[model samples]
Target: MNYEGAVYRPPSEARSLIIQVTIGCSHNKCTFCYMYKNKQFRVRKIEDIKNDLDESRIQYREVKRIFLADGDALALKTDKLKEILEYIKLIFPECERVGIYTSPQNILRKSVDDLVLLSSLGLGIAYLGLESGSDTVLENVKKGVTSSDMIEAGKKVVKAGIKLSIMVISGLGGRELWKKHAVESARILNEIKPNYIGLLTLLVEPETEMFKQIQAGEFQLLKAKEVLLETKELLNRLTVDGCTFRSNHASNYLNLAGELNEDKERLLKQIDDALSWKFGTKDEMYRRL
Candidate 1:
C-alpha cells in the first residue's frame, strides 16, 4: 500500500486492511494534533487507489474489513467516495465493512442523502474526534468547530444509519476549564448518542503548539488523579442510552470499558477505585503519543 506519513485509525480498526484514500488531515491546525503535520492534504488519484486494491487482492485471500486512511477520507466529494466504495465492493467481495475518519466539517459539507448513500455502499462506520465539546476548550485547541456543530454532524451520521464512534480527549481543557470540558462533552455525547465512545487521555507531543504552550505554562495538564476526577465527573453526567465506552488507550492512566446507562455505575466505581489508589494506573514512562 502507498501509505503516507502517520496514518491513524480508531483502535477498533486494528484488524482492517488500511488504504490511504487521502494524504493528510484537511484541518491539520488542531493545536493538540501532529499526526499529519509532515504531509499536505490531498486525495489520492483514483487509479492509484484502484492499483492498491488490486495489489491487496493479490496479497490477501479474503479481506474482511477495510479502513480508509489517513485523516478525512470522507472529505472527498460524494461522487468520488461512491466510486471508491463501488470499486471496493467489486474488488473485495468478501469485505464485510469499511470505515473512515471524518471531520465535522466534512460531515456538514455532505448532505444527509450523501451520507445515506455512502452507508448503503458499505461505508459501515465513521470515527470522529470531538476532542472537547466546550467551545472554550475547542477554541484553545483550534478544533475548528463548535460543540453544536459537532453534535449536528454526529446526529446526521447516526441518522444515515452509519455506525458513529466519537472520541474525546481526557485532559483537553487542562485545569483551567476542566469542569466545562467534562460537562459540555457529556452533553454533546448525550445528544449524539453515538454507537461507540472513546476516551483518550491528553499527551502533548514535542514540536506541537500545545507542547510549546505547556512549556510556557499557558496550559496546565491535569495530574493522573485529576484526570480520574474529570473522567468521573464526565461519566456522571453522561446519559447516552446504549453507547459502548472505552478508555483503554495507552495514554489513559486507567483502562475502562463498558456499555452506557447499565454499566455507568460500574465504570464510575472503577474510576473511584483508581482515584483512591485502590486500583493501578499506567506508568507515565509507558505512555505514548
Candidate 2:
C-alpha cells in the first residue's frame, strides 16, 4: 500500500490518526487562521485516499479512531465522502469511530439525511469552528456563517444524532469587542447546547489578517490575564443544559474541563481566583504560563 499525497500528523495523536483527503480549507478566508494559507483546496483522487486508508490499516492495525483532514474533509461531496467512509470501515473493521473538521458552509449545504447516512457509516464526530457568535465579529473574521446559521447547523447535527464539538476562539474579538464576543458566544452556546464546547485563545501569526489589524492598531491583543478575564466572562454567561466544556489547548492560559451546567460556577471561580491574585508582577504570570 502506497500513499501518493503527503501525510501530516498532529503532535497530540497517540491513538488517533489523521487521514488527509483535501489540501487546504475550502473557505480559507477566516482572519484568524494561517493553518493552510500556502496551499490551495483540492479533493484528493478517491483511489489515492483509498490507498492511504488501506496503508493505514496495514500499518496501524490496532487504530481505534481516525480524523479526516487537510482542513475540511466534509467539503467533499456527499457521495464521495460516503465512499471514503465506507472504504475506511472496510479497511479498518475494528475502528470504533471517525471524526472530521467541518466548515459551517459545508455543514449548511448538507441535508440531514446526508449527515445521518454518514453517521450510520461510522462518522462519530464533527468539529465545527464557531469562532465568535457575535455576527459583527463573525463578519470581521470572515467566518462566513452567522450566529443563527451556526445554531441551525448545530441543531441539525444533534438531530442527526451525531456528536457535535463546536470550537470557539476566546479572544477573537480582542479588547474593544470583548464584552460582545463573550456575551454573544455564550448566548449561542446556550441555544445550541453542543455536546462539547472547545475553546482556543487567539494566537497571532505574521501575514494573517489579525496580525495586520494588530499592526495597524485596530485590534488590541489581550494580555494573558485579560484572556483569563474574558474566559471568565464567557463562563459566567454560559448557561447551557449539560454540555461538557474543554479549554485544554496549549494556547489557552488555563485549562479547564467539566460538565457545563454542574461545573460552570466552579470553573468561573478558578478563573476569578487566578485573576484576582495580587501576585504583584507580570513575571509571576509568565512563570505560571
**How does each model score on TM-score?**
0.96, 0.94
Q: Write candidate 2's Cα lDDT for 63-83 as tens digits.
A: 789888877788999999999
Local distance difference test, per candidate?
0.92, 0.84
Give per-residue CA lDDT, model 1, range 1-289, as digits (tens). 6576777888999999999989999999999898998989999999999999999999999999999998889999999999999999998999999999999999999999999999999999999999998999999899999999999999999999999999999999999999999999999999999999999999899969999999999999988888889999999999998889999997888889999989999999987776666433446423421
Off by over 4 Å in 2: 1-14, 279-283
Model 1, residue 289: C-alpha shift (Å): 19
**Residue 206, candidate 1: how far off, in angstroms?**
0.9
Q: What RMSD does model 1 have?
A: 2.4
